[model samples]
Target: MKHLLLGAAALAVTASMALAGGHSVVRMGTEGAYEPWNFINDAGEIDGFERELGDELCKRAELTCEWVKNDWDSIIPNLVSGNYDTIIAGMSITAERDEVIDFTQPYTPPDPSAYVALDAGLDVEGAVIAAQATTIQAGFIAEKGWTLIEFATPEETVAAVRNGEADAVLADKSFLDTVAGTDGLVMLDRMEAIGGGVGMGLRESDAELRAKFDAAITSMKEDGTLNALIAKWEVASQF
Candidate 1:
């Protein structure tokens, strides 16, 4: 009888430890400048679709989450170096990127891509354009007679255009909406349909973590929570 009781206690302890390990705090990284997806506000607070979605996923997964801001160019490297566990920025899951980091099932659908002008009379047609390096935007720019000015983040590219350092910037349609009516920028032209769907990035070894995130995202989509959050961020119309 004593042996039986001892074995039961051991099982309970092991189960408790497993549960504790499963709920470990997850470190999530974002650009904190991709508005409607993730961005830091003027008051230095992080807000947007990805931020809210991260919070919701943490709640559903029963895990604690910490949000970190980093340059978009370094986000993948940081994750690979263990600086962050997951990426919640407006990162697209592309075949090229898959060679480095794993991605959760995409939560957002691909939105239209556009080029925006910084000043009036600045004909973007056949002018140099800026976009975040290694993105689909760069490929699109390569097709045009436009020289590519690669920035570390979308916000930086937009800043360059706003400051007249670049003639135009290429980014998602929702980003154009967010930047419109500010910095005297206006949409120049819409380009070939580009995929800008957002996903969570994880290390290749962290398959379990990726699974949890993917499951949570699927649930959110099925129940309309994802759509609601998109609407709250004022980006649903852009999709």
Candidate 2:
């Protein structure tokens, strides 16, 4: 599989125009591939932590919201291009990403990153590691000077491990749990939480929209509603 490098984000130079005042219908984009956080359920609807959280946020922000499913690799650029007003895809908050898009305060706490493979143990430093493109895990592998194989979606990374295309797949421990413990794949008994909490991604120019969602996220964080959702999805640790 061809792996795209991080420079793909350099295309997100388009500035978002100001949204009209008042609560207009807003569009929320998600990968709909990463489970528990966001995924397509049997009915083919977007269902998961982010779906519920995004809906509640829109209600609290007093905006009519619609869901937009986009491939993981293009989510950010699409948001910058006005394809969506907000990104509720389980996107991590990082300084590199912050330069391209702004983020709301964390809704889900950081998750431990894990190495999982068909083999129980592998040489992380020398083994080929698969990670979803544009994620913290992918960056970590590069920073560690390890061979990194990038995929457009989380499922593809895991599949690479299963297909013996990669030595291991590095991703959120919780996400890997859904695949590892059940798919004959095993977690490497080694892992690390390498980034901050997951948050909503908005265009850098959408300060007003970011603020509105930030306030809504703050409300959730204050009320224990966010904790309930965290437990509900079993995605990661709570704030």
Candidate 3:
């Protein structure tokens, strides 16, 4: 749900700094918060499934790439404003977002959406659901006419459910699984698909760059490298 809304561009100057050796930099922006997809490790580096995948794609494309951490809610806007050249974050390939930015052919297929709650008493149809703002999960809650509580980040949404601010949180099952296992949370019996597949977001002007990554992803798929990464991350859903 953490859709990029351009609130400010004060960091544009720093973001536009060039790479050395006359090599064009392909800065990869990610929300370094969500785990298993992309998250900051103890060493203070972006480390996760997307991290590994991004490096592989960059190597295959022969791009001089670097990771850029951006807040999830502003990720898309920063990319549009040139803070980064690509988004290696776990962004879904949705029609609404496609209108604003181009997406590579999906590397991660759409995983099922699940509802996690502290308990089973809340009526999902009428209960207040927590979702990160501007996400498909948030849209789904709104579409169902459920009272939706919006948060700026996924952690905040899950925290809302823990704090009784929401009856449940709707999110990707892989993500919810991590939180549910340790925090006394539980998945409800409701599960569904909300969006298409997950892909890297790119600027519409970066068609050539998108093609490079797409080709690399296709190669990985053909050789089973992509599935290996998915399985390694325990995000086993495949196209």
Candidate 4:
């Protein structure tokens, strides 16, 4: 009886550990510069759509999440090198990216890209349109006659346009609408709608975690939590 009791206690401990360790504390990556998606405020803290979404998703998944700011160009490589367990920097789901990292089902669907000008009457046609490298917008810009000023992240692109260093910028419609009220900026025109949507990135081995996140996203969408967030952020027009 004593031996049997000891064996049962050992098995219980092992089972507890397995259950406790099943979920990982995922490190989520973001660009500290993309506004309405993820960006650093004047207070030097990260705030915006993606950050809020990450918080909500973490709550729904019942997992601990850490946010890490990284350059857009390095976001993927960092994921590949195990620097982050996931990325939530308004990253679009694309076949090219799937070749390396796994992605959750897209949470935010893509909207039309738009151009904005800081100065009135700029008369910009061959303006320098900014987009992050390796994005669908980059491919679209490559085919256009306008000068393309590629940036390491969307934050830099917005900054360039605000500083008058670039005539205009091409970005998601939500971002454009968010910046419209800022001094010295006006929307130019909405471009073709890009159909791809944003998703969280995970390592191929972290399929279980990805499944949890996808389920959480689906629930959020179904319960109107995601739409509430978009409304709270004042980005509903992009939908």
Candidate 5:
């Protein structure tokens, strides 16, 4: 439940060293908790839009890749520490994050941040907002000087609202769609656009790897494969 507005700055200070690179198999790190973006399936394997897209990207890059599920709170630290080679999580590209790590051209377009609450008329200005820790939504709340409560995972944020611990939960609209309008929860009409878009996170020293994935993503965008995947996942509007 740490505020990324603060944690991201700390990350920039400490994440100065890069891990030695020479691995034959590239590890793709993800939360595996955010569905439609990345999640653990019935087979207990990583499956979702990023999983599908990442596999194809690896293929195009001619690199062997494997998926690694890491906690969202330490995803970036682990990547810089060489626990993984790349992050394929649904992480928004931001200036604060860019200071600590490198990102490829966005594969997914910018997604709208939305608030979901039990009642449609919740006064957002005075409302207690719940958001997943270290996310753009949480940072946005902190930046706005809103009454913010953060949780370790996306589910916890929704739970905070359902339990009356918060007035509403703010998160990615696509992520909220799976739960919005269910169990008396409704997504508000208002939306906040935060961050640039979702992209692959890499260590600053991994220029070659970053370039490979960037090329692959660019090719996907040019060929409309990326748009097709976006439609299939309903993650965001297509480019």
Candidate 6:
């Protein structure tokens, strides 16, 4: 749960920048803070499951691509504003987001949402839940009428729970798993499945580009390479 809102101003930019020899240079946008999905490594370069997958997809599509790091809250807007051509971040494919931008065929299966808290017996239903703003998890919490605390980043949500600002922090299981058992945090028993699986976000006008990446994703799913990467990164369930 991370990307959801966008403004009409985002529709201003129409296409990506072109490189020499007429080859399209695609700028892949991402929230580089989500580890295992995308993040900055010790070398100060973008490195993670998405970084690897995006590179492979570009090679398969025969497109020259570069990674662009953007804040999670403005990721969608930046993409629509021509700051980037595609969002390779671990964005869930949801109907709400589909109305603003196109999404490629999902590369990863629907990841289960989990609640992590300091106390194992925390009453999640009535407890104050922390979620990244504009994410499906945040929407879900609000829809449930539960006390919801919104944070700008995933780390902030977890921090809220740690600091007693919230009873629990709800987020993707893959992300929670990394922090569980550290700093007295424990994963709760309840798990909720949210959204349709994660995919590449593209502009509606980039149908041709979407097709290229979709084809590449289909090939990966067929050849078992995508599953291999999923297993390697342990981000989500494989296709």
List where candidate 2 sits over 4 angstroms from the true fold: 1-12, 20-23
User: Per-residue CA lDDT of candidate 5, range 103-131, in tens?
Assistant: 99888888888899998998897899999
Q: Whole-model Cα lDDT per candidate? A: 0.72, 0.82, 0.81, 0.70, 0.85, 0.87
Pairs with steric clashes in candidate 4: none
Off by over 4 Å in 1: 1-23, 118-123, 143-145, 236-239
What digit string (tens of lDDT, one per residue) describes model 6 on residues 1-239? 45575556555545553322344688899999888798899999999999999999999999999889998878888877778889988999888788888999999998889999999998999899999988889988888999999989899999998899999999999989889999999999999878668999987878888899999999999999999999999999888
Better of 1 and 2 by lDDT: 2
Residue-level lDDT of model 3, residues 156-185, one tens digit each, is 999998888888999888888889855768
| lDDT tens digits, residue span 1-239, model 4 | 00000122222221112211464667888877766778898888788988899998999999898888887766777666667778888777777667666789877666567777875555556677776665666667777666888776666777888887788877777777777758678887556576477788777767778888999999998998898887777543433
Clashes of 1: 0
Q: For candidate 2, report its TM-score.
A: 0.90
lDDT of 2 by residue, 20-88 (tens): 254377889988988878899999999998999999998998878999999877777788888888888
lDDT of 2: 0.82
TM-score of decoy 1: 0.82
TM-score of each: 0.82, 0.90, 0.89, 0.80, 0.92, 0.93
Task: Report the number of backbone clashes for model 2.
Answer: 0
Winner of 1 and 2 under TM-score: 2
**Clashing pairs counted in every model:** 0, 0, 2, 0, 0, 0
**How well does model 3 score by local distance difference test?**
0.81
lDDT-better candidate, 5 vs 6: 6
* Best first by lDDT, ranked: 6, 5, 2, 3, 1, 4
Q: How many steric clashes does model 5 contain?
A: 0
In model 6, residue pairs whose N, Cα or C atoms come closer than 3 Å (at least 3 residues apart or on different chains), thus clashing, are none
Q: Which residues of candidate 6, in runs, are more than 4 Å off? A: 1-3, 11-23
Question: How much does each candidate deviate from the true structure in C-alpha RMSD?
Answer: 11.8, 2.9, 3.5, 12.1, 2.8, 2.1
